[model samples]
Target: MAKYLLLIVEAEEAYASAGEAELNEVMEAHNAFAAEVGALGAELLGGEALQPTPTATYLRKTRTDDVHIVDNPAPELKEVVGGYYLIEAPNDEVALAAAKRCPAGFGHVELRPIWSFG
Candidate 1:
């Protein structure tokens, strides 16, 4: 078995333009999905929903041996990483199965294997 990180990205419009009722519905669905994933015996390490991008910060390395820090996200896109999940599964297929059940409106879920150091 291996641990994978499931990155959940939500369409900016779905989030930014969502009303309170719509947001509540999405959140309810997400919670249900999470519970289902947990029942599958996959370890849920941790996860969280990020705030809006306006509060994001960016940093980059410069050729002058300096690190330039900025006050916003690197790129302005229609989608933003909203949350993530760390799960243990036998293969990518299983991980993907869980990710597909997430409540993201026309959004996407990316699965990446975690590198174990030990």
Candidate 2:
């Protein structure tokens, strides 16, 4: 089987404005999504929701041999990555199908295949 990553992207502002009821509904959707993928035979390897983008730290190497660290990666980027899902499937088609079933809620899900030595 091959591994795939479902990168979740969403607008943080939307999340901030959502009420508790909306959040609960989103949670239920995620639960349903989990059941749906399991029924489709997609093995969920691992996944997690990340903290807000403001908590992120970015680093880069400078030409002068100094490593620069910045707390803000891109302040102007309105859409930020919210979470990801790692899944294993027998083939690309199956992986894609599984990704389609993911409940991104207020965001869009991007599906990518994990690099394999084999």
Candidate 3:
């Protein structure tokens, strides 16, 4: 099985203004997706719902051999990674099918294969 990372990208503003009912609906959808993974014979290795971008801390190495730190990515980007799911599937087709079912009401889900070096 190969590991894939499903990035749940979403518009921050949409979630920020979501009401209780909307938030609950999204959560329920995610719960259903998790359940579906196992039923589809895929292994859900791990997953997480991230906090708002403002609460994030980013780091990068500068040309001067120093670590540059920031709070988030480009502020101009309308969408940000809201959550992620690490899943192991039999093939790319299965992973793509799973990604299609993931709910990203405000944006979209990005599927990426994890490279193995061994």
Top lDDT hit? 3
Report the CA-based lDDT of candidate 3 relative to the real structure. Answer: 0.91
Better of 2 and 3 by TM-score: 3
Question: In model 2, what is the error at residue 114, expressed in angstroms?
Answer: 0.3
Q: What is the C-alpha local distance difference test score of each model? A: 0.78, 0.85, 0.91
lDDT of 3 by residue, 1-118 (tens): 9999999999989988999999999999999999998777678999999999888888888666788996666989999999999999999988988888898999999999999888
Give me the runs in candidate 3 sitting further than 4 Å from their true place. 62-65, 71-73
lDDT of 1 by residue, 1-118 (tens): 8898888887776777789998899889878887888666566777788877777777778565788887665566778888888888777777778777766674888888999898
Residue 38, model 2, lDDT: 72
Give the C-alpha miss distance for residue 63 in model 1, angstroms. 12
**Candidate 2 residue spans exceeding 4 A from truth:** 62-65
What would the per-residue lDDT of candidate 2 be over residues 5-88, giving only the tens digit for each residue?
A: 999888988888999999898889777877787777789888888898877878888665788987686788877889988999
Please identify model 1 stretches exceeding 4 Å from their true place. 62-65, 71-76
